[model samples]
Target: MTEVGNRHPHGTPCWVSLLARGVEATQEFYGRLFGWEFHPGPSSLGTYVRASLNGKNVAGIGELPRDRPLPIAWTTYFAADDADKTAELVRGCGGTVGVGPLDADDAGRLAIALDPLGAVFGIWQAVHHRGIETSGEPGSPVWNELVTRETSMVATFYSLVFGFETQHVVSTDFDYLTLQLDGRPVGGIHGVGRGLPRDRGAHWMAYFEVADTDAAARQVVQLGGSVLRAPRDSAYGRVATVTDPEGAVFTVIRTEPLPA
Candidate 1:
């Protein structure tokens, strides 16, 4: 069971998933990283596997289309009251609908979509499935963000569809827009070629929680994953950017402890 009824001004973000190249490899990597266990599950879609951390439902990883070219990446899902309606809103907001408001067995209705700037995300109408319960913990999702050249359009499109109002600083020189769900910062949008190398296209990156950012970064290198950026302290947490052996980008964050 998932933690339910957590809503925001826009809508509740319920589920998160990933499409992996070597399903077994991803399963092993993430399971080792996050202490999660994977098992075959009954899905309305083709084949689905539920990922559990310490025996609790945490996230999911699925196989991509073997018949076509695709990238291995994590996909974040925002909770929707009606996935089909949200898909319409996405199109109306100038975002493209890549997939469907199709059924995923009894899990819920889902659709793959791109923001106006082409960053991808998903919509989930959870029935039996709620969403990711433990985020900001080692092996679970800590954060998700998107980068785009059209930062203004990204703000307007998401605001129009999901009602997310972005938070940004005017004088900072960086075009960083924080995705606020019901006033709480959920994700962010940044300009391309800023704080990263050129040729890095617009994409969504998920951050996993870790107990020690330094140790995790070392482990990433030891395990053959490339470290794009070493651990650095931010106002939110200490983080490091990394790419998996397959070249999928992600983050590892260790948040600062709150005052007692």
Candidate 2:
């Protein structure tokens, strides 16, 4: 298991949070689905709840602001050394800053932005909280992926903003790019294929590691969620896509165990 203590390097997918209509129900759904435990954040932070695995922070959940009701979805946050500078880079690269380089109490400075292709994401400069405390284990985030029609344009935009080394995978079925930080794969970019609905547009999706993809998918259904894609074996492992009761989508994968 990878236990992260220090701040993540720039461009790494450091954190993710779900903005839902009902915080309590969201908490219970994930807790029952992934064996996660939730701890409420400071009251001043509204209804934010940190989801943990084995006592380590894995993700966060909060109610959608009443004034600015957004579609229930998980937002992927990439690490940045300077939130303001990253926001500026986003704008300069034809992206739009949707939120702020605003302070989140003493936790960090954060800003939400849209990529040129319209995928919304967050940038975080950590202070008191250093993003997810544990990763690459069941119940923790394992990967973040961007799906877009503008594969080359999106690739160039992220590479310019985050200094990521893009590695394109050769495949006739689909176009895929791996974003690397210091030569280590951190995230991926997938070209939206014809098989997907045209109205789907561009978006960032988070994937969580699971011990059993079929079992997790079943739990999701039992907890009022729906499985968009049934569990299927892939080159990577067994994978499934599911949506919470509020319709926030995420992927789960049962990866092959590493050689001892």
Candidate 3:
């Protein structure tokens, strides 16, 4: 198990959460699908619930405010040293701050923003709550990627804001770029393709590791969720895109097992 106790490096994807209207159903669905244990956050946090795997924090789920309804979706958060300063950088880089440079009590400071290409994400400056404690393992987050139509423009925007160095991965069929933070791969940007709805524009997608993609996808259906994309084999792994009962989308992958 990878136990992450300290804050992630700046620009790394530190956290992810689902904001949904059906909070109870969402919790039950994910809890059964991923074997996650849910714990309610401080009452000051409203309806926030932290999801853990084997006693280590993995992700979160929160009630979507009725006054400002949003489509149920998972929001990926990047680590920042100062969310207020990062919000300034986001604006300077042609993005717009949508919410906060606000504090979550003693947990952290955060801001939500829209990238130049319209992808919404968050920046978190950790305090008492460091981000995810277990990653790259079964039932933990393994990757995060932005799928956008304006690939080059979004690439430029994030690079300028987060000091990301792009490592272009040559592919005959896809335009893909890996975002590297201090020489380590943190996330990726993928060009939207013919298969996806162009009207959907750009969005960040999170992926969690699983032992079997097909089995997990089946469980998602059994638990009242929907499979957006059926499981398929890829160079990296077998993957499937799915949405919770409340419609928050994410991916699950079953990669080749690590060497013993």
Winning model by lDDT: 2
Stretches of candidate 1 off by over 4 Å are: 1-10, 193-200, 258-260
Query: Which segments of candidate 2 are over 4 A away from where they belong?
Result: 1-5, 42-45, 193-199, 258-260
RMSD of 2: 3.1
In candidate 3, what are the lDDT values of residues 1-260, reduced to their tens digit?
Answer: 12225688889899998888877888888888999999986466589999999999999888888999576789999999788999999999889999999878778888999998778999988888788998877899999999987467889889888889998888787789999998998999998666445646688999999999999999999988899999999878999999888777899999765568
> What lDDT score is found at residue 228 in candidate 3?
90
What does the lDDT read for residue 180 in candidate 2? 93
Model 1 local distance difference test score? 0.76
**lDDT tens per residue, model 1, 188-259:** 777754554454456778888899899888887776688988999997899999876667778899988867
**Decoy 2 TM-score against native:** 0.94
List candidate 3 segments past 4 Å from native.
1-5, 193-199, 257-260
Question: What's each prediction's TM-score?
Answer: 0.89, 0.94, 0.94
Q: In candidate 2, what are the lDDT values of residues 1-260, reduced to their tens digit?
A: 12225789888899999889899888889998888998876455588988999999889898899999576789999999889999999999999999888877777888999999788999988887888988878999998999887478889999999999999988887789999988898999998666444545688999999988999999999999999989999767899999999899999999876668
Ranking by lDDT: 2, 3, 1
